[model samples]
Target: MIRTVLVALPLIVFAIAGLLAPLLSPYDPTSGDLAAGLQPPSVDHLLGTDQLGRDQLSRLLHGAQISLAVTAAVLALSLTVGVVAGAVAGYLGGRIDRVISRVIDMAISLPGMLVALAVIGVRGPGVVNLVIAMSLWAWSPYARIARAKVAGMRDSPHLDALRLLGAGPVRVIGKHLLPPALGPCLVYASTDVGAIVLGVATLSFLGLGVPPPFAEWGQMLIEGRPFLASTWWLAYPPGIAITAVVFASNLLGERLAGGDERPSILRWILPARRDRTVCAKDDVVLRVQDLSVGYPRRVVADVSYEVRRGEVLAVVGESGSGKSTSVLAPFGLLDPTAVVTGSIGHTKRVGVVFQDNLAVFNPLRTIGSHVDEAVRNAGRRPVRRVSEELLALVGLPAVARSYPHELSGGMRQRVQIAIALAGEPELLIADEPTSALDVTVQAQLLDLLARLRDELSMAMIVVSHDLAVVSRLADNVAVMYAGRIVESGPLLTVINSPAHPYTRGLLDAVPRPGAAPGTRFRTMPGRGGAGPDDSAGCAFAPRCPIAVPACGQGRPVLDVVTAGHRSACPEEGV
Candidate 1:
């Protein structure tokens, strides 16, 4: 933003001077006083009189009107044509993108100066012809940039979600596609302005543009060329002015475009700012009250829970029970299709351990580099030191230089934990943290998590289908079924004496040693998936063993059972 202002300052001054050219200058730009020809700087003529005895400052100010106007017109024309073409091509791929891209390549290959000269030669030298010729090829760069940007972003999650919401192509492109594409295009147009202006002057210099004693910078230069040795004042002023404008514009545009070729040490030198935590005033790490995640249909609804510092809230449910969706909703990490509702509060930032280590970890980056990136993003300098410490903390002291593929499943999970810890986030969300690990490794990782929670004083929300894991690690438990939490409370109470039938069903399904050898384990009847989107009654009524006709009358909510315990239905208990 600073760069943009600085570059625009010179143009602002030129505009004011141009508008007041007659008032500011003591002499007419065209009607030169030949009697005082070949004069250098004096009290009367600020920049001296030209060979035509015209005030140099006056001609320069007047020339700015023509130059600035032509550049502005060119930018408007180029961007309009380029952006429209590129957007259509990018968003609607196949023949359209290929055909337009081919045309762009051909157009770019044409020699711009030669094409302009040829056009001027055919139509004769004039401003209209000059503008037409220059504008012919000016849009190519913007077209290519817009096309690439839109094509890359066309399949992004948000755009896909917008489509699923029944948004038309025009609305989607205008709202989602154009914004990202506009940035690079604007930067190109800004920096290209000075060049386009300079091109106009060059055309005039070659007798292909504004000709005569009409007070143009190029025409003035032409008149002063013979006196180069005799007087430097004649040509140097216009030359310096042109150079300054282009330099300032390029400097500003490059920065605004964020064209940094590589990372800078300055990022490390700058002190990091601490963002205010969003946790409750009473030391609650995270809280989600009446939260619901909406897809095209509502997936999870009216779920509420809180996690105090160092406490783990395990969200347990079977497949398609919205365990992942419910846990992720609090962090605002659900898919874009999910319209999350209700309140979520956290005192500090969050970090996560993803379900698939390979999908989340960059294939090209080593464990150390991955940890370094996380640390750097968190504003910690010298990532090497922090990464080393975090690796030791996660019990992988020797695996810093190892790649994701090089480590075992457990070691990779530790790397994920280390990366999460790098941010020093107050709340950590681990989605099915033990799913891919062997039983022994899962036990080790859960134990590691317990120790880390104690050491870091951070709260966690772990999503899983395993009851044994929850009983061991979770302080609080929320059992979900049919896109809703059936029961929630202290883990011990919920585990030992669950009050909701759905919660009881989940616990009963797990195989027990007391059962006879070779006896089959219990399983819930019905699909046990998310309920119909428009259903008015309890979604789990169909599968509930104790469900009566009244259970289908209305949606049930979490009602208080015992102290510090809640159940969605009052009918069942362990």
Candidate 2:
């Protein structure tokens, strides 16, 4: 509360001072009174009169109006130019990114004051020219900061989420990208405000600022310099005013640059609330049929799956088997260059918990706000109350006041989960939610997820490389090897009586608790398998221990081995 007051006071004071300068000055700043000349601290002339017999105080106040106006104008103009250029460069990488980056580098390499001077020299000194000159140099700071920030944002999960929501480049950049970028841009703009004021003053002092009768602070300093030794009142008052105003603006900008965690106290006093409800039991929550996701090569192929109400379907595979890709593709979140073909259907709301929690959030925004945004975007009810409740649900009640950087990896993951559950999604897609945490935290998160699944009666699709995770969470299992599902069935049946050679190999790969110390287990060979072209044949044939002659000719179909079990192997048919 104290911090907010300290930050806001200066801005309010400066704004009032800037707006009311003309009406408040005591005397005409340019009119001379020869009888009052060279007076110092007189009762009749507060702050005394200058060498030219002008009211020093009045001139100083009027000068502030010019300096503040220039600063405000420069900040607005520079930030606009910087944000547009930077966002374009960062969002569209490769050639465009390179070209924009090079241009920014060239601009930054030049001395700012010198560039401003050169521009002023050409345009002729005035309030308009000063603003233009300051803006030319000022934009580079925002460009650099925004470009760096946008580079990081390009790979963010929220961006992926927006893309999956069918938002085009313009909408995504305008809505999602611009709002988050505002924090850093504002911080940079504040600092630039101070720099611009100083630049304008420097130019005025050099006779390049507003013309003589305007009474700008920089011009006062320039005009007073000749009489400084005999009449200290001539130069000191305007100089002091310039210092105080710039200092106040800098301090305010610094505080704002830190970021605003909550809105105002008034906003909190009238806090808005929202209500969240669970989906119906009969809802056909989620479906992905024959979903094949490929990068340069096919990473996961011919995978068919579905999640009914209140069920969990876990997709388990090694790191390269495309478990992540399968989930991302169905969400329409993959890069445009990646080839994906599949059909997906779900009547319930869809939400995802990504592998890296921090990557999904804006580092500048509070966790509570992000949760609130999710609730709003999903059109959920009880927005404020549900956001807080969801935070508590994920064991992160205290995280409402914290930014992404302040939270631990596990805490961040929990926050991510809270955000996903904000809308009470009927289908939750958790992709390696526990991969970055320690065992204890991982277990806690897993338990929380299980409880939430039952409480909300939501279907969940869990993707992971850990078979143990699958064993604990999945009611049904889909086993992926290379780029295709080699076996899938009820968890117990698939684990205990696996049919495909690849499934057996995967089961053997799980380390046993009682195994001898340093004992190596059976391993698959040959460079962890082949590229997508290898899709012409059985994806796992090259690595399968029992591969036969026919395994090399063509890929096999998933033949039924039991009522709910299927395997893709000709040898299994034999």
- The root-mean-square deviation over C-alpha atoms between each candidate and the true structure, in angstroms, is 14.7, 11.3
Clashes of each: 6, 6
lDDT of 2 by residue, 513-560 (tens): 999999998777765444344436876777777888788786688889
The numbered model that scores best in TM-score is 2
Expressed as tens digits, the lDDT of each residue in 275-363 for candidate 1 is 12223324787778887777667777777888887689999988888888877776667776778789988766788998987788877
Best by lDDT: 1
| C-alpha TM-scores of all predictions | 0.52, 0.54
* lDDT of model number 1: 0.78
